[model samples]
Target: MTDTAPASSPAESPRVIALVDDDRNILTTVSIALRSEGFVTRVYSDGETALKALLDNPPDLAVCDIKMPRMDGLQLLQKLRETSALPVIFLTSKDEEPDEALGLAMGADDYIAKPFSQRLLIARIRAILRRSALVRGAPEVENDEQPAEAIRRGRLEMDPLRHQVLWNGQPVSLTVTEFLILEALAARPGVIKSRNQLMDAAYSDDVFVDDRTIDSHIKRLRRKFRSVDPHFGAIETLYGAGYSYSDG
Candidate 1:
């Protein structure tokens, strides 16, 4: 007699997320929360092991603890940046605001303070993963048979199809959130976007992030572009009103 089994659907294939922390409790608790949300998790006790494993088999996203034994999160991230562009989110303690800012400045996609809400974390993870999928064209359905072409405003060029950003003809690396915010503003040049509107663009409806989060991302974006082009001042800040892209 032959047995038949139903094939696993695309939705059943859980997205992999790596969790690296020195605390066993955090690892276990976060793993439970992630698994409950239909995400496969890889837990590592230290940055050293996590870095090694991540290089061997990369995950869709990673949540790393800032303070760890031997190899710290910053060190791990710096080393990883040398070879990989994998998205990273740092887990910081309540008193580590400075560290969180530094991490963001150092190219981390995002950060979560200690005593974080599991629901919030899940929402953020989903938001990041969704953006990644959009960039990779991995969405289950084709909503648009004719996708929009790349948008070019001055030296800043955004390619939705290729998920590439060129600043003065040089490649500029941007986080998913940063890219979305820039795209939103640049799509309509000279139009100011409020903090709330920019937040809506960077995150999903389920993710309720602070306005200041958008500010941080904007700062990072500026620093990144300035690194590529010292005179890069395309992103204009309207203080209180929000941000906009300069056409000239």
Candidate 2:
């Protein structure tokens, strides 16, 4: 059976924020809070409905709870990553919540424990949207130094203009964020891009994305690249530093 996120229309608004949770109270509070901030909000009660709506027509951003019946937020996020760069944040219980380091490994952009404030939630949501928007719109930088290229690696070829990625003479499906990360690392070629550097580069000149966001994207990139070729392991983790793309 196919799974999907529910869709709702708050207004004919340009910006939309989606909230998915089994708890009616949390959904109501978040929806109201987001609306007060001048954003159109869509609320879904379960992962299946949320996934459906998202597939039919995706929202600008989504806030989902970590635990749920049926599909769960983790599965939804993985599914979403297959095609969209929609920004996402997770709501988690204080004691059960995974640490920033652990959560990033599972591909969450941001995680807020149960006792989170409305203000912090709102601010984090806004930050992700702003950064995601900026990063998603950076095809025409017109760099004078590198003669401007689409997605050219030593052996990999990607044409962001066409939204295409290939590794070792084959097509590879990567989320928009994943493709961008790989492109940035390759652009450096032997240069280490620290977590901060990766964040800045991925968000396109300092728009501001969470450090965990970069980590999540990098994890996905490694999976996709390694699937193509084990030695295609161009990305090197400098432990505390960041990442480097070396043909080495």
Candidate 3:
């Protein structure tokens, strides 16, 4: 009998990740760690260079430093928000609550403290990429019937498959974290979801985030929705309980 050996599957191309940090040590260390996990990294010393590189050639995700010389991470994120929905994870060195809150409010997917473990970073990266891939239809859902492409509740419409959101027929731009949080809340309207529950849904693999992080995302979500509908009051907060979505 002729011997038949099964051909091995080709190796998949590594995902590109942009790393923006003023510290050379971080760039080197993080890049090496990421490379070992089969991720291609493009490191930048400042936000300006990173912004230019991202606008010209976008990456699968970006890890940015909160403080940098000329064009800080917050400023760069603001600029990027004006055009693209690039997923960004802020790297904050200081243990300041405001800085972390601001970053999350400004649409960062996640944040990590400076003295963080490489394993945690890798886990967050994988979690985000998996969610994004699901939206992009990679290794699609295995079911006899296709899942609904869009979920609509009153004026708000969310298309999980397309990774798109619309309020009153107008498109609303949201970061990966924001979208995930909103999706979780909207999935079951009028149900109060505690901070812990929200965190479990949006940031299951995220290590450094806390309850305040979910609150920040909720505040930002309200601002975004209200901007579109001046009288928007969909997301309701129960003081002692948690948060719930109200179509009315």
Candidate 4:
């Protein structure tokens, strides 16, 4: 494990990003890139070591590789979710679509295939951090000027400031991406949002996500809501079109 502390003081500290992967080259390369962008980076060679530090002192976000010795990204994410909501982005092989889907289903904020560009990775990191900042109500990073008021749609309720969601009055846990997508739908009940539109709502313009990425997130959203209420069906799919929220 290697830790790089930011030069900034606590009062003006930059965001901290944890990088977990067995490849030393990736650790070195990504850490350097992140540091250059004013981010403090902590790199771990494996998942087990990363998990302990993650729980002991959480970072603003984490980028983890799916395949690793000791524990793997999936296991680390599973354990982390038990206590923390730290934003995570998975690193997967280009051919590993199943793993990407699994990682997203396990609550990853996003995923980037291996051999990724530093610019794309950095863009994704910034995007997730921005969403997280909004959730935490950080004034410096708050891009939206609108009020962070709570929104209620039938049995579903969302508190943007608190980053809280409820179904039938029961709390439901959602990742930053899922929360954004759901919010876009619920904010305009019965309005169908195409995959591209939904992607725009949840991701930064510079970061491109395939249609499957949005589809996986939608499935995860429905699954989470269903876990709270077996009959959960507020999200509707329009064949060959997109998805919409139905409070009625």
Q: Candidate 4, which segments miss by more than 4 Å at Cα?
A: 8-11, 142-147
lDDT of each: 0.80, 0.70, 0.81, 0.88
- Candidate 4's C-alpha lDDT? 0.88
Tell me how far the alpha carbon of residue 204 in candidate 1 is from the true structure, in angstroms, after superposition: 1.4
Sum up the clashes in candidate 1.
Answer: 0
Off by over 4 Å in 3: 1-10, 140-148, 205-208
Worst 10 residues of 4 by lDDT: 140-149
| Residue 39 error, candidate 3, Å | 0.5
Candidate 3 residues 2-83, lDDT tens each?
1111133227656788889899898888888887777888889998888888999898999999889999999999899878
Residue 89's C-alpha lDDT in candidate 2? 80
Sort by lDDT, best first: what order? 4, 3, 1, 2
lDDT of 4 at 227: 86
Models, CA RMSD each: 5.1, 5.4, 6.7, 1.8
Model 1 segments more than 4 A misplaced: 1-12, 141-148
What's the best-to-worst order under TM-score? Answer: 4, 3, 1, 2
Candidate 1's TM-score: 0.85
For model 2, how many clashes? Answer: 9
Question: What lDDT score is found at residue 109 in candidate 4?
Answer: 86
Q: What would the per-residue lDDT of candidate 2 be over residues 1-248, giving only the tens digit for each residue?
A: 12222244344444678888999889888777777777777888888889888878787788888788888888887777676656678788876545444545555666677878999888877666654544445433234322225656667786765556777788777644565577778877888889887665555442445666687778877877777787667788888888998766
Lowest summed lDDT window (length 10), candidate 2: 139-148
Q: What is the lDDT of residue 206 in candidate 3?
A: 50
Return the TM-score for candidate 3, rounded to 2 decimals.
0.89
